[model samples]
Target chain A: METKNDGPKQEQRLTKKGKETRARIVAAAAKLMFERGVAGTTVEDVQREAKVSASQLYHYFQEKRELVHAVILFQTAQVLSAQEPLLSHLDSIDALWSWRDAIVSLQVERQCRGGCPIGSLASELADSEPVARAELASGFMKWELAIRGGLIAMHERGQLRGDAEPERLALALLTALQGGLLLTQVHRETSPLEVVLDAMLAHIGSFAQS
Target chain B: METKNDGPKQEQRLTKKGKETRARIVAAAAKLMFERGVAGTTVEDVQREAKVSASQLYHYFQEKRELVHAVILFQTAQVLSAQEPLLSHLDSIDALWSWRDAIVSLQVERQCRGGCPIGSLASELADSEPVARAELASGFMKWELAIRGGLIAMHERGQLRGDAEPERLALALLTALQGGLLLTQVHRETSPLEVVLDAMLAHIGSFAQS
Candidate 1:
């Protein structure tokens, strides 16, 4: 059932050089898309940036859509890995505060230039590109699940109330985070994110088992 | 103050025909941008879609960036005017619930296709396009102000506690709304938005003067 268009699947069977070239192309595309948006980045631009020949680029991604899909997954991993240390320590409120601080500080350090990388991709592709849309949704789900797991751990430790719904609360926290990033991304300031995280954390604090 | 490159200021002095043509171009651009995004859209596509001659297009918007700015304003107005009626009734907690219902209903009606039109634009242009970024930020500010004004009204009526901090609460509410819309847009479901709004409203209810 393999067709000529099954370039992506066959790409997985590449040699180490081919795999490295593929990864390099994806990394270049991700950086370009982050700066210029999915619509702005072109296959030619990726080829030039990644220093891959057009044939080599096509060997990895048969189409631009396929490349974008790979970029979404790449960004999802990049965003999550950066937060892994904080994510693993979220059993305590102090850990949550630390996590929030890390996020804000990262924004500040980047001069609030780029919002959440995964969020930017999601916003651009969600409506127009169906495949990328699903992948982005899955990315958000993974992010929310990570946050929810931490909340559930806190509930198990009796830090949160018995009635606190971990799933809903985690969704809310993730939403606040996205909203804050959207505002901060536009304003090029950390105030919106700070205000959002603080308010959301206060709401979470209210549910503590006193 | 009359510079040669003052394309926008001169546009304000248009005749009836000129105004209509300008509006037509903006509306067409907005529609295309909504579907294809700013990067994917071009002057040629807009000219064809708007049915304006090349000279006419340049007469209105000297460049694509100028057209994008107009589209941003168009979307801002489109988003705000739809909620104007509900926004005016935020004097009571019931009004807030009604507003929330209206938003959810609107999303359901659209099958959760587009997130906030303004939000989508913000995510794409915030970093790459400075003027558009500022315009998008202003749009969010206007939206936040409307919400903050409502909360302030409630606080003034003693419906909310004296320490409710309407500004922060409004920002938080706005954040939650944006986050919910982002998730909903990608998932093509109303549940993410529904859950976020409900949880945010519950938090607001906690500040009610009982």
Candidate 2:
């Protein structure tokens, strides 16, 4: 009887440990993925990074695809974290431009290298299957909405112009960053990216009072 | 003597029939890449689509990677072709705006789908190997020069404000498009992307005669 009940009871008992081990595996995978493109990240590499044996890695996730999906979700949340606080403070034009500048400066310093982990993963996963593509799509929707909501809030406060199109600008800003990053990465330089950001900032400033 | 003669003979031998066959193979490969994603495209599927036997396919290209490289070069040329006359005609703000609009409209309609194929392939292939990445990088550099040259021409004609920074603005335009594409593709919408374009256009217009 005890043996029969142990299956469910065993899972419950192992829940904490299971979660920790799973997180370790994902972190390991993410690091490897960033250091070497996803295609270069082998299952064995991930297992070794996590300090787990092959069987243990497979036990947590059936395959590398499943693990990658989990990582996408994890990375999306991390991106959001970086954009917050500053985002929430955009109640005035000063705040918005400051936020804009913050974004531009950060990207310039970083030289638009690497990529948005979520965006990068989405490109890979979307072309493969509808299910995975849907997940990738969800991350974008959520990201866009976060920015849109802030823009709308600023508009309502009279800090933004009455005609300000927040959602549209937000989408465009996101897109430019992505494209700019590609160019910057290819050239291993930042001038082109800076030009785009400078133009955007000037445009955004037009809606704000001096 | 035989080896030298064969090498030169093979280099010169792209007969009409052979050219058509090679074209078919590349077209099939591009379609498969779009539908299945680059990683998912298989040599067998490409051969089937082209309706060629394995021996014939291998005869044309010694390996699948060679076929892919050919496809990339072909696609790079296609994109450049689309932008040519416009690229050469950016002698005024109106020309620049019209050119920008054409690109934005094309992208938004596609819902920011795919991405700059050259850039996408480059990002994925950068970690693939140095030689492959170098080839990919060359394509993007060519693209940048094409636009930068246009901007330089516009400036020479005194169409752009003397104080204006054409190179930087060009980079910004490209960046916004990339980011917008990612956003639109992920969200399955175009409104956000258009907003970014509008903002980008408005920004550039500030430096125009109008």
When just chain B is superposed on the true chain B, each candidate scores a TM-score of 0.94, 0.82
TM-score of each: 0.93, 0.80
Residue B40, candidate 1: C-alpha displacement in angstroms: 1.3
Query: Can you write out model 2's per-residue Cα lDDT over B148-185, one digit (the tens) per residue?
Result: 67777766677677887777766676667666655566
Name the regions of candidate 1 deviating beyond 4 angstroms.
A1-12, B1-12
lDDT of 1 at A163: 87
Model 2 lDDT, full chain set: 0.68
lDDT of 2 at A130: 51
Worst 10 residues of 2 chain A by lDDT: A1-10
lDDT of 1 by residue, B52-162 (tens): 899989877888998898898789889999997988667677899999999999999998998989999999899988778878888888899999989999999999999
lDDT of 2 by residue, A1-210 (tens): 122232234346557889788889888988787656566688899999999999998887687777776666667677777777876665555665676667656666765556567767666555454555676677666676776677677777775687777766666656666666665665556665666766776776677642
Chain B TM-score of candidate 1 stands at 0.94
